[model samples]
Target chain A: MGDKTVLYDAHMKLNAKMAPFAGFEMPIQYTSIKEEVIAVRENVGVFDVSHMGEFFAEGPEAIKFIDNMMTNDFMGADLYKAVYSPLCRENGTVIDDFIAYKIGTERVLICVNASNIDKDYSWFESHVTEFDCQLSNHSSNYSLLAIQGPRSEEVLKQIEIYPTGDFPYYSAKEIQAHGEKLIIARTGYTGEDGFELFCSNQFITTLWDKLLNAGVIPCGLAARDVLRLEVGYPLYGHEIHDDVTPLDSALKWTVKFSKNNFIGKEALENYTPKYRLVKLSLDKGIPREGYPILNEEHETIGKVCSGTMSIISGKGIALCHVEKAKFPKDKKLFIQIRKNIVPANYHTKPFITGGHK
Target chain B: MSNVPENLFYTVDHEWIKIDGDIATIGITDFAQKALGDIVFVELPDVGESYSVNDTFGVVESIKSVSDLLIPVAGEVLERNDDLEDTPELCNESPFDNAWMLKIKMTNAEDKSSLLDATKYTAHCEASH
Candidate 1:
């Protein structure tokens, strides 16, 4: 039995197939991965993502503290705006990638991956000596729910809590629902236009019930994985990890090299990527993580990082890191699937794109 | 509850088999298909292929993970399901009928003695769950 979220009982009542993820007992699926995925793509779906970690950095030097610690520059970000960044070690390897929302001049809220909560908190705590800021781990104090898809706005309207003012993309707003304080963010992981709600644990069950009653399909982690992969999003454990740098993981855009002296600035400036992450489309077999990526000569050049069959495209798509020097020339790649080597075509764009409305 | 037809024999690995004379038809049970979520790809053995009991003959790839299709009886494959190559989702929609993966001529008819009836198979699924 792992750590159960506040929505654990709600998931059980919905007949969710519970599985362990990042040391938390979470829902893997309710009815089926395909069904849930389609519902989110064509209609609306809700996901209980309360296992994600949340932390607060508050004080006078909060902006400076965040800008220096992450690879991205957060000092110039506007209030209520979110910035995506990869937290790197001194050696330029990624610790984790997270989103930082500038809630106020003296306060910034950071949302991080659940698996890296402990390490990230310690890393932040160890660096606050020079800054006049306080770092607090509020992971257990809040619950998160992501309402995603094309029809997400309709569901929010049905709940009667949709923000009235300018709630642009990647923006956060604090609102009240049913006399409870709730933080609503126009951000999501499924490459969909959606809102993520963060509220006290006591209020989450009610919010979940409201979303479900409003005809939002209950989705789980499996569907979320496929949805993100269809749009070429990187998962932490699959695409980026302690041994993989942002440059190698195709996340160099998140690293602002112009920033004055971040944690991995010097190392990242001199570092050359060993492997370059690229997308591939397969017509034969589904590619999986750690599958051998071969060249025309059948030589193992690299390995798949994140791969799945996109039900939307009806084909296999993958994000794999190939040796920078051994990258395919003719756009021909082969994924060694079980006993057969299946041919693939290299693609620069995502397999499917939608829900950005 | 999953559909477990009374006429078919079952294995502990969640495969359902139907025997007629010396020929045996094999497929994953409805319980197995439901557990696998959606079947995205299916790898079938070629006709005239031979296998022993419990041998991994093919593969079934779902949206979540891959599972090996195990042969329940020793036999030579007489026919293979060609429709699965184009539409693998039949495994989820009709696991017992159209999704029958292979038709093998049994080398030893006594293999049926080790299979379980529907009532016993239902008990096995309940206990495992």
Candidate 2:
């Protein structure tokens, strides 16, 4: 058995298929992954993302501490605007990728992957020797709900927590709902326009019930993974890992070299990437993780990191790390299914666009 | 509770078989389809292929995972369900009837004795979960 989230009973009541993910027994699907994916793309869906980790950093030196640890430029970032960045090792390889919200000038809230809470906290603590900052792990005290889709604003408007229309993308604010204080952020893993709500366990449960009563589809992690992959978003363990650097993961844009000094800056500046992440689509076979990707000569050149059949396009899509020199020039890629090699074509990412701003 | 039809014979691998003379129709049980979630693709064996008992003949792909289709009885594949190639959700929508995977001519009719009955299979499914 694994740790259960605050909404465990609610998921069980909905007959959700519970599975262990990142040390938490969370819901994988309530009805079906296909239906939930469709709901989020065409309509609206809600996900209990309470298992993710949250850390609060505050003090006079918080900004300096964050700038040293992160690769993104947060120097002139506005309050309530979240910045996506990667935490790297000394060798420029990724430790984890996260979103940081600058709630105040001297205070920031960092959302880490659920599985990396302990590791990330320890890393933060070890790096705070030079800076006078306080780090607090409030992961257990908060529950998150991601209300996502084209009609997400319609669902959020009914709650009246804040003026949903005024909140811009990648922004957050403190609001009150049901007489309870909550943090509402206009960000999500799904490519749909949505908000991620952070609040106390009791308040989260209440909000979940309210959203369900208002006709929001209750989605699970399976649909969430598919939705993110459809939009060419990277998951921590899948696309980026301890061995894969941000450069190889197509996240070089998140790394700003203009900063004076930061962790992994020297290594990243000197290192050259040999493998490039590419997207491939197949019409018949569904490619999966660890499947060997073959070049035009039928030689195994790389492996698939993440893959799925796009519910919107009905084509098998995968993200693979291939040798930079062999791709585009080779022009053709094939995924080796059990006995057959199915042909696939390299395509530009965000396979289906225009869903998110 | 998963739907386990009374007359069909079952395998420990969660495949169901219906016997008629020397012919046997085979497909994954409803319990298997539900466990696999929404089936998106089904790779069928060729109609003329011969397989021994317990041979992996094809595959069923779901959005989240893929499972191999194991043959329960020794037989020669007589016909394949080409319809499933286009609409694989038939396995989830109607596993017992419309999603029948293959029709086979049995090489050894006595192989049926090795399979489990509906009661035992239902108990097996419940126990495994």
Candidate 3:
């Protein structure tokens, strides 16, 4: 068995169907994916995301070091505003995508995907020696809980320790919840109005029980995929990797060239994207990762990075990479779905939710 | 949650078959639906499609993965659930009532003895878990 999460016993106690993912035994679904998807869309749901990576960086140079590593203009934003940034290679290829929250000049917390934790840590260690920042990987000691959907705010309000905030998307605040400190960020990967709480593992189980008592449903990775696909969020391993740049991942707006010189600035400025990522809605069948895309002339152009049946849209959708010059957002492509070929329409979709956070 | 019909014959692969005279109605069990999670797409076989026992039929696509709905008995397809074309989640909500795949006329109905009953099937799932 791989490393287990702090909530492993809770999952087993609830008879959750465990599946191996990202080198961890995670709950694929507790009740059902459809029910969980509907709950998150219509009501409220909570997820155990302790498998993700979290790090705390502090020092006088933490601001300079952290700001230099990202490609967004977070330094100029409001105090509680969160910024999505792409960590990059020296040659402009994106290493990973993450959210960087600035607590103070000497303190910042970075949340990253689990698969890229080691690689990202090594990347930081290489250049951090010159920045005078103290970086610590606190992934093992912490557990993350995402409370999402239309009723999330109401549920959070019931907890006396949770501070009431009307912060807009990409905003966060440090608060005390249930007699414990938490960093509640109004951010999520599922394109929903939700709060991602970073708290200690010691209290995560108790927090989970409290949420369950509040009638919030427990959702798993199955519904999370559909929600993200409906909003056209690009997953790391599917639509991005070491070779893919943020520019190719359709996140060019997140890159700021005007910022001070950073590790990958030179390569990003000189390089142009070869394939542009596009959102596709499948009419024929369920699109999947690694599924090949056929051009108008039946030529192999790109591959699907992530795909699912959009619960909100009621259609099969996928995020794909296609040749930049030849890519047409309005064009149609034939996706090889099993033994048959089905048609798909392409467009540029935003990553936003319907409910207010 | 243990509601497998005692009269119906079940398969190791989580398929349920009901024998009535010479005809049989086949479908994936409730346990199968719980395991498959949300069923978003269903690929049904044609009415004229014929297959032997263990022959690969069509596919059932969930949000996370796609798996084939294998045929458990040798027979010809009599009908396909047309409702699943637009409402695939019926498999998860009501697997026993509305999620039946097809009705086939069994070639040898007595061969059903190899399958399990409700008591045996429940024990099988409990041990596996």
Best by TM-score: 1
| Candidate 2 Cα outliers beyond 4 Å, as residue runs | A163-165
DockQ of each: 0.89, 0.90, 0.73
- Which of 2 and 3 is ahead in lDDT? 2
List of clashing residue pairs for candidate 3:
none
Candidates sorted on TM-score, descending: 1, 2, 3
Model 3 alpha-carbon drift over 4 Å, by segment? A163-166, A177-179, A325-330, A350-353, B19-24, B93-97, B105-123
TM-score of each: 0.98, 0.97, 0.90
Native contacts retained by candidate 3: 1.00
Native RMSD of candidate 3 (Å): 2.8
lDDT by residue for model 1 over B43-94, one digit each (tens)?
9988998999999999999987989999999999999999999999999999
Candidate with the larger DockQ of 2 and 3: 2
Docking class of 1: high
State the fraction of real interface contacts model 1 keeps. Answer: 0.92
lDDT by residue (tens digit), candidate 1, A87-178: 99999999999988888899888999999999999999999889999999999999999999999988898888677888778888777778
Which of the predicted structures, 1 or 2, would earn the higher DockQ when compared with the native? 2
Q: What is the lDDT of residue B116 in candidate 3?
A: 85
Residue B93 lDDT, candidate 2, scale 0-100 = 93
Q: Give the per-residue lDDT of model 2 (tens digit) for A278-336.
A: 88889898989999989877999888999998888888889888877666575688899
